[model samples]
Target: MGDFIDVEQLYDLAMTYSVKLLQALLLLIIGLIIIKRLTSFLRKRFERRKLDPSVRSFLLPGISLSLKILLGISIATMLGAEMTSFVAIIGSIGFAVGLALQGSLANFAGGLLILVLKPYKVGDYIETKDHSGTVNEIQIFYTTLDTPDNKRVIIPNKELSNSSLINYSINKTRRVDFKFGISYDDDIKLVKDILNNIVSSHSLIIQEPEPKIVIGEHGDNAIIFYVRVWCKREDYWTIFYELQERVKLDFDQNNINIPYPQMDVHVSNS
Candidate 1:
């Protein structure tokens, strides 16, 4: 009789827990769907505010993770866990774990600061003392970069946030500067005209700023002509290299002498 009673009680307990488990499963699915919609809505709102892309990339995942944690706690509470005690236990455990993983926590903090300050974003070409690359991703602990040579680099958030960085792609337009030195005997007006023609011929160079070509300084062996031209950021290198090559070829054709450093030293025994 006792064995039969035990079996009956076991069945009762199983049925009772099974119902709660099914309800929890349904709640979990519905909660996830709601979270997805909520996150999407928040993303649109963030975009409307014109928040930085890096900030958006960093914040959305954090918010979703937090919401999901809360959802989990709610489900646990519904399964007969004490809400207040459960939260307290979680809080205490998080505190302990945070203390244990202080370095990781610092990296997380640095990542937050980076997102908030808007130093650089994904697709921005940035350079540091050791690394130079286009930013590929920003994660909680590290930032990934794709170098010009097609190498991938992973930098810790702590090091990146603390270091000085140059963001080359921040501005819409970039200035390409060139200093060309010609022999003192070369005709200045002719050289300037050739440079102007070169600038005008190029489709990539912008016309609004007006290409600057003028006598900059007189070097020991040559007269330095400074050239400054503005172009779209992506076209900067193309314009720079092409102009240099064109000027060299044009100068050779016109017999406009490009002077090299020469020192005339007379050594005599007095």
Candidate 2:
């Protein structure tokens, strides 16, 4: 009878431990789900606040991951588990992982720098390392650019922030300069007048600067005229394309000859 009682007590103790283990697991799962939902809610709230997209992308993911880890640790403690040893183990592992991912960490830091610096905004036209494109999106590791040829290029934030960046849309207006050459025989005054008339007639051209046209140079076979105009940034492309077309047509109608390269070839017969 004494041996049977001891066996029964051992069995009851095993059952109690198993039940506690199961409850701990359930608590962990519920905690994770709640963290997920709360993180999502915070993200949406930040978005509604019109936070910078680049900032929000990294901020939300980082905060959520941190919160989930903390909650999991809390749940573990409630299950009467010793956490100090586990935390020490995680700390050592994290140090090793961080060393292995140093380059990725550098990129993430660069991305944060870009978000804070505000060198260029979304939809801004920029040139970096000879690659010209419009910024489509900025992310934690990389930035997306849409090229003029409709190509999507992903550039690492590390390179982007480190390199020189040229932003074209920084100002509300931009200057467009065009040089046209005419036959030396054409009157310089007449050429200037034609360019001036065209500039003034263009609707997109800004009048404050008062477009300037002057004789630039006298080439071997032609005379050059420099035409400078200013227009709004949004109208830059339209003004550029239209001015080229109109200048060619007007020059032709006025009998102005844009010089073309001519080579004199000599053949010798022996």
Listed in order, each prediction's TM-score against the native is: 0.76, 0.83
Q: Considering every candidate listed, which one attains the maximal lDDT?
A: 1
Clashing pairs in 1: none
Off by more than 4 A, model 1: 44-51, 136-139, 144-154, 181-193, 200-225, 257-270
Error of 2 at 255 (Å): 0.8
Per-residue lDDT tens digits for candidate 1, residues 218-253, read 988899999999999999899989999999999999
Enumerate clash totals for all models, in the order shown. Answer: 0, 0
How many clashing residue pairs, candidate 1? 0
Residues 1-270 of candidate 2: C-alpha lDDT, one tens digit per residue:
999999999999889988988988888888888888988898889889988766776577778778877877776777776889778878998899899988777788888888889888678899998688998888777888899999999888888888899999889999999989999888777778888899999989999888888888888888888888999999999999999999999999999899999999999996
CA-lDDT, candidates in order: 0.92, 0.86
